[model samples]
Target: METVKLGIATEYIPGRVNVGLYVSDNGARLIDSGLDDEAGRKIARMLEERKIPLQRIVTTHSNADHCGGNAFLRKRTGCSVAATKLESVVIENPFLEPLVLWSAFPFGELENKFLQAKPSEVDLIIENSGIVDESGLEAVPLPGHFLDMIGVRTPDDVLFVADSVFSEELIEKYAVMFVLDVGAALETLDRLIRAEAAWFVPSHAPASENIVPLAEANRKGLLRVSEAVLESCGEPASREKILQGIAGRFSLSMSVSEYVLNSAAVGAHLSWLRKRGQVAPVVEKGVLLWRKTR
Candidate 1:
């Protein structure tokens, strides 16, 4: 991962999951760690080369990819870790992630590192939005992709928007982005549309001076998925059938892990639509089915 400077006080390492570096009086704090021990070791080497002391790690969310390196980083540097409540739980009990996804003790494949990180204790639980004085970073709530995900806004005006928006190329490649709450995701996008920052950093996407277009694209993507879910249920289909129709339309070839993640995402779309009175559920032959209601 290469570090790009946003300001004297702020820099970030760009990768599949971007990690923000913020300098404060105490020491250098990382916004998020990368995937695992290897990622943690690499980041530690980078910091050592620069002669920076690792002091704290502020995680955006509990996604394994985002916080997987926390344990190694903390072991290496004794850095304090901070995260929102729900994410904090998952961080502390990594196995809970796969449990939530599979709704039980997950199968062997579901227990992969992609779904669960090594447990890392959180030193700080961000109870409210605004400046978190410990690291001199502001916590901007950006819920949707995961439970209680937040973005970090640096003093230098660089916003680390964690998985709130994905690039157009990412959309074309993956077709469906994982989200836990489609309604909250859309609301977060709406909030981002009016936000201004010197630079906006989305974990999976490239940083940009303007994120409005990206936000709009996310809104469109969510709407498109919602519409697809609605259209796929023309005949009152079960959740599995709805998923099959959506996957077929997108021509998505998914592994078991990918299928479960996508199924959760599709379930979010259904919940959003149902909440808005755009869809309804029925019990047919003892199986739950969903149908569009205009």
Candidate 2:
């Protein structure tokens, strides 16, 4: 097994996103690229310092903060960009289109200006369980935070788990998480815990040698969110009403944008519950009411 040098980029406050560079006989294969031009420049400099030529750039997901530097690095290193097939669409587009950030939240204007899409084209698309012949690294789909998320497992026993789990600090500060599919997220975390790996490197926090504990904590947090939603409704409530109640409970205000994002997350959870026959949705007075299935 080859010993790979790992570099972490701490873009967000207090939290670091791990972007792995697997250097082997062929060249350097990057695991995940951080958001924006700055991150790309940093990675480029790291490669330059080591005199390693970047051969490929593999992203674990399409979220802005994770794969945001794809375009920049591809432009700079001329490396092919690889991502899950489902995420290729998001990366190519890179924006929450048709959803006006300004009209949606309190920091609408700020989000609108800063959260605009930084679209990039994909050079390679990998399916779930597909092998990425990145000169020396293997990338596999992990799919939890988003439908098309992936994690790269190098020969050195390191698995780059992107945004599927976070540290306690991030969990508390970013109380509200952006998830495309809650059930999938839980399942993905479970898979990560079971997968054979020496280190679980998440894109938003420090890497963990043992991810089971953190995974358990995240599962409990998710359950807490579900319970809070159920209790706030008092009765079966529409998505909007449930979100409003959740925001009130957290002392957080919901903007239109926030509501949209939150609804998508809640809807994913509801979908999962329905699948497990744990919850059922009904129409009451023309409003959709979600109730625990009996």
Candidate 3:
């Protein structure tokens, strides 16, 4: 965990998932925790060594990688946890993540910490879009990665965008980015393009003064996944068949967890295409299949 100071009041620890730290009159507040107990411990120790107070933690979403350290941090520091509505429930009940991913009670493999984090309590639920009263931090709605994912804009003019955008290398490495709403994700990119921030920090990407290029790269990646799914539907295909075609096209070999995540992502793309009248669902011989509409 390397802490890069973005401003006098803002600093972020870059990891597989970056954690944002903002110092206010009350104390220091974190944007999101890292992947596990060790990460939380390191963050706690970092603050303690610097003599910085840990007062609040605001998670961007309910993804295990983003909030996995919440329980550990909260337990050690007694800091208040805040998240938007859709995320708060799953953060408090971590099992819901794998459960929803599997569309049922998750199997043994899906129950791992990679898919489910240790549950933590939330003290405040943020408004859809505005300044969080207690922290005085602005919450920018960057939904579509998960249900109600948001980016935090510190008073110092640095924006901590969650997983709304990914680096070009990451997009190229994993062609099929995880998304719950393709349309919303694209819209969020548009929003980011218009944002005026001195520095932008994405959880999965490097922080930069200019984020438009990264946003555009991420947009292209989403289009690539959507095109792949659309091409696979040249022949009417069931949901599983479409997923299989995607894996084959990407040379992806998956465990059950990967399959579930990709399946959800593909489903979201299909939904987006359907909404735009680019695809349609057809039932033949009692089997539902998705086919290109236009």
Candidate 4:
């Protein structure tokens, strides 16, 4: 066995989920399992090399890439899984609307195939600003990507920022960033920037010594998109119209599957904006119209 190690498991080519295994005198703990059985097996192999017994698996959030390996790892090591309370339900029931699922570009069928939520329960439901009592790790509340999203910090000041920010290549290639709550997402970025972390390790991308610049860029991009939505409507527009306008404006060349995923991402953002009082929606003629509230 290699002992405890920090490994980067690439879920998509050039896109990775960072897994950290903590081996100590007592047991071993894993932070952010990768996206499937294969990924889990790889991590297990690494652990076996280190001769460490896996004891706990903690996720920064419930996104598929972050938690998909949960079941496989749990079955292998019998480690208890834990996540923030807000994401437990969604993680357990990963279904998205069919339309939204199809809207996702490139990998549309992935929504149908992989969007099925895995059956894993959170052994520990972390409250807001709660600490995860695992070896050399701290779980901090970081809600933006998802309602119950969190960041795991190591004693060395390595903060595992899960989908909070992405590499420049990912941004350019994906064109559209998936955010459930734009406002909250920005706020969370601000929080992370202000925190005292030496390295920002994103689950789906490489770590950066300084993430503030990228975070700022992403924030501006989101604000620009929001402004575009407001301008296209001229007046308050329905949620559907706003989404359509966004797609048109971005010139997104999406297949049916991509379209569904994109729709879900837009819907999630709109819902977040509504919750934050940044936007308001009115039902008109059996359709929902959304407008900037503030």
Candidate 5:
């Protein structure tokens, strides 16, 4: 609802999802939009009240909570949307968000706004050039939390870190944050650990000048989840049993949505372990089972 100024031209509206604002002589560019039409409209109104024109929306990824407001903002402000290749596909399709999570044609239950954001056109396809072309904002490749996620750096030195890391409280509360690639997430953490920025803003966590403690916490949280998977599968286990066991271990009570997301995170950990030859998967009586190889 309120914008916190980070620099002369950069301000971020922090809430359930943080929306970054960067201004220049031409117009304003939103780093990422929040959940839906409501969120988008709120942002539009705030900008309009300040006599600011929204020229573009650079989404970090295709996650609904992050880019869900794109459609509404684009329609209302006629702003061009920009995102990386894979995320652009899901952003334009929208349905793919819930589809991938549901692993097929998603059912009605999984079609909620939190999972399926309204489709928005992508006017620009960002590459790995670091510089996001016309805008000149540096797009740092932040792979792992989602496909082709990037952290946008304004000239002022504030980095909109997107979802590469979770708040320490979230890690303790949820026990497992959804990750598309555990390996990539770990690597991203390393990058954050060594990153130099005047300020780093995680979409979910508060912005900080020193992000090492938070980055280290994320590294440990990821490893803790990976270790839990290894220990749970010491005797071979199906992905479903593994997920449920981890949830039980963390005393987590999940809805259908949370179940699907956490299930995906567990799968990512399995993939990471398999890639390192730390775990092996076998089919037993038609049920796929994973066991720690070493």
Candidate 6:
């Protein structure tokens, strides 16, 4: 239902999941694929229609939505996939994603397409923040959304910021975005605001020439969510109770999938607060309870 932007050497495909596309005389490169095989098939068709050979896929993270098309595209066009070392681990072994969310062997509810993408091989592992490949694309470290997440800078100076910041509209719709580290995510938003770039393309947001405003909005959103967590923890509370408080605060109706993701987000906030000496957790009678300490 969305159209891929054309008439430029580098432009992002706009959809629920935006893909950064770069085409040169040599071959075409994509910043990320999309949700599943269907999305991958469409990408392959687009490149085929242009008679452009697909070269490498630079994956930003290992999230199912981000890397789901990896296997399909690689199989269809034989494109090499690149990602950070830790992300590559999950990209190749996707079960770990559901495993971490479930905190153990995941149940059937957690084993779905959104959480478990088809296994895809990662040919290149981005080791650090610099030129990722011979194509001259640079990798900028963007921690917090996922472990070892990095935004890619194309040669055209377009920054494909992967899941680091939410679009204002998305922020309004879902006030609390999923994050693995509240502290690191806030720091990343600040970094994005300060970074110099001709354009910043957030995966779920529109591309913008100036990203400071969007970055700041995301910062405030995260802060608000963190504050909500504190408000819920005036007294000792279990993780479920804390989640319930947050849901009521936001009036969110969650399915099981949303529950696990939001639960993880709550855990991240607790960890951040605990690190800052704002909250402490105690296991009393085998029931973990969190209480505000500061």
By TM-score, who's the top model here? 5
- Backbone clash total, candidate 5: 0
Taking the tens digit of each residue's C-alpha lDDT, what string does model 6 give over 21-139? Answer: 98877898899999899989999998898798999999999889999999999999999999989999999999999888879988999888899999999998887499987778899
- Local accuracy of candidate 3 as per-residue lDDT tens digits, 1-294: 468999989999988998999998878999999888999999999889988889989899999999999999999999889999999999999999988877999989899888899999999999758997676789989988998999999999999999999888887776788999999999999999999999999999989999999999999999999999999889899889999988888888888888899899999999999999999999999998999986
Model 6 gets an lDDT of 0.89
> What lDDT does candidate 5 reach at residue 277?
93
Off by over 4 Å in 2: 1-16, 96-116, 253-259, 283-287, 292-294
Of the pair 1 and 2, which is ahead by lDDT? Answer: 1
Put down candidate 5 lDDT per residue, 160-261, tens digits, no spaces: 999998899999999999998999889999989999998899999998999999999999999999999988889989999999899988999999999999
TM-score of each: 0.97, 0.83, 0.97, 0.81, 0.98, 0.97
If ranked by lDDT, best first, what sequence of candidates would result?
5, 3, 1, 6, 2, 4
- lDDT per model vs. reference: 0.89, 0.68, 0.91, 0.68, 0.91, 0.89
Model 3, position 220, has a per-residue lDDT of 90
In model 3, the runs with Cα more than 4 Å from the true position are none
Candidate 1, residues 106-180: lDDT per residue as tens digits?
899998889999999999988538987666699999988898999999999999999999988888776788999
* Candidate with more favorable, higher lDDT: 2 or 6: 6
For candidate 6, the 10 contiguous residues with the lowest summed lDDT are 1-10
The count of backbone overlaps in candidate 1 is: 0
Compute the lDDT of residue 157 as modeled in candidate 1.
Answer: 93
Worst 10 residues of 5 by lDDT: 127-136
